[model samples]
Target: MNKQTETLPDQWDAPARFLHWVSAIWVLGLMGLGLAMVNLVKASGLKFDLYQLHKSYGFLFGLVLIVRLTWKFIFHRRKISNRGFLHQAAIINHNLMLLLLLTLIASGYVVTCFSIIPIPIHVFGWNVPSLLSPDMLMEQGAISVHHMIAFALLALVLVHIGAALFHHFILKDKTLIRMLK
Candidate 1:
């Protein structure tokens, strides 16, 4: 069969696998940094530095996400199976993860735009000019949404990891092995 006709049991291509791992690292690292800045760090220069770093990395992650999605849909689309409910659930989970990441990135930009801080978003020395004026209300609202979505994404990631482990250990499947390969 041609590549497009292949099923889930087939291994993911090297670029797809690499992008998957990179996306995971970006999501987890950004989430951890965000949590640390909010819960552990106090209002100080260090806190500001951490927030700046978070924004920079977040900007990069957004680009990576876009490329990953484009690669998946245009270059290397996965064919979902009609075989079982488990396969369908996996597709849903994967799509939801992508949606959540997209939402987080958009909301994060809104939060930064409306932030009371008098600083512009500087991603790797590229100063991103804000289009919106500082509005405390909008900033607060977006922050709330961003925090909620972040926690939701974290939970979903845990579920994704659990499913992979279940497939590898319980089902003795190649699902996880294929990704690793």
Candidate 2:
């Protein structure tokens, strides 16, 4: 059999492993950025360009998430056994995380696009339409939903990381390590 078809004992394929860790790092960075932006927004009167920075980072994150999703779906990788409850739960949690991330990115972009600021930021050379123009009601609604989804995603991430740690240290399983290169 070819090397590509041969499964490693405890290591995920290089692409899967790389994307997993890189995406984790990206998420952590985004979490830090989100917290900082929230605090900065609350503490008004600061001349710092917090909103611009936050929007730029959000765009970058959204792009990365899209690419990661594409890579995940396009590439073939070794599938770990899911015969146990823990494995099934992990699979479910991981899938949920992917969904949450996509939702967060979409809502975040919509919120930013509706901003009153006239700064020109084009994605793929195409201008994204603002969800709000003279309609303040829609803007408010989208913002509310965006905030709610962000909080939900944050909660899910906490649970995911905690469960991984529990499996690694307490259960002494290969659940967490299997993804490691």
Candidate 3:
């Protein structure tokens, strides 16, 4: 039998699965928090509070992404079986998701650091200074980039979720199961 038809592993390693779920939950929650912060609130006090929380989680998410990427590099990850178009599509989607997420995170950092308004990021009660000089022009550009990337990231995430469900229910393949348990 060819490699494409060979038996696959029973399941993904525990840490890989853990990272998958953690990143998913973190990104989803951040999206909700982002929506609420922009739409549901208007008061300065509330906005500040929400922004603080958002910045904190963004930092946390960055750390998680770092670890996840490191784990993938250090360990053996299962390659997608070259069985058909569905498998290839899933691989492409996964790569795009990662790229979009990294772009989102970098633009987010630029937005906060180069903000026209200097807002200190409090991590565990310690203030972290903004990384870039205050420039109104740069701030506007960063804001634009951040927003555009965020919207793109959201669409990519939806595609990822839909692909998972399609594999699980329609394709009845091990694609989703490999990550689930």
lDDT to native, each model: 0.90, 0.70, 0.82
Q: What is the C-alpha lDDT profile of model 3 across 1-181, one tens digit per residue? A: 2354546776878998999999999999988898899889999999889988988888779889989888886775555448677667767877888887887777777788887787866778877777788788887898788778778888878888898899789979887899887
**In model 1, what are the clashing residue pairs, if there are any?**
none
Ranking by TM-score: 1, 3, 2
Error (Å) of candidate 3 at residue 112 is 1.4
CA shift of 29, model 1, Å: 0.5
Leading candidate by lDDT: 1
Q: Candidate 1, residues 1-181: lDDT per residue as tens digits? A: 2244455656788999999999998899999999999899997999989999998889889999999999999998656436577877888889999999999998998899999887777877788888888999999999999999999999989989999999999999899999997
As for lDDT, the candidate ahead, 1 or 2, is: 1
Question: lDDT (0-100) at residue 46 of candidate 1?
Answer: 93
Let me know the TM-score candidate 1 reaches against the reference structure. 0.93
| Winner of 2 and 3 under TM-score | 3
- Candidate 2 regions with alpha-carbon error over 4 angstroms: 1-9, 40-48, 77-80, 120-134
TM-score of each: 0.93, 0.77, 0.89
Off by over 4 Å in 1: 1-5
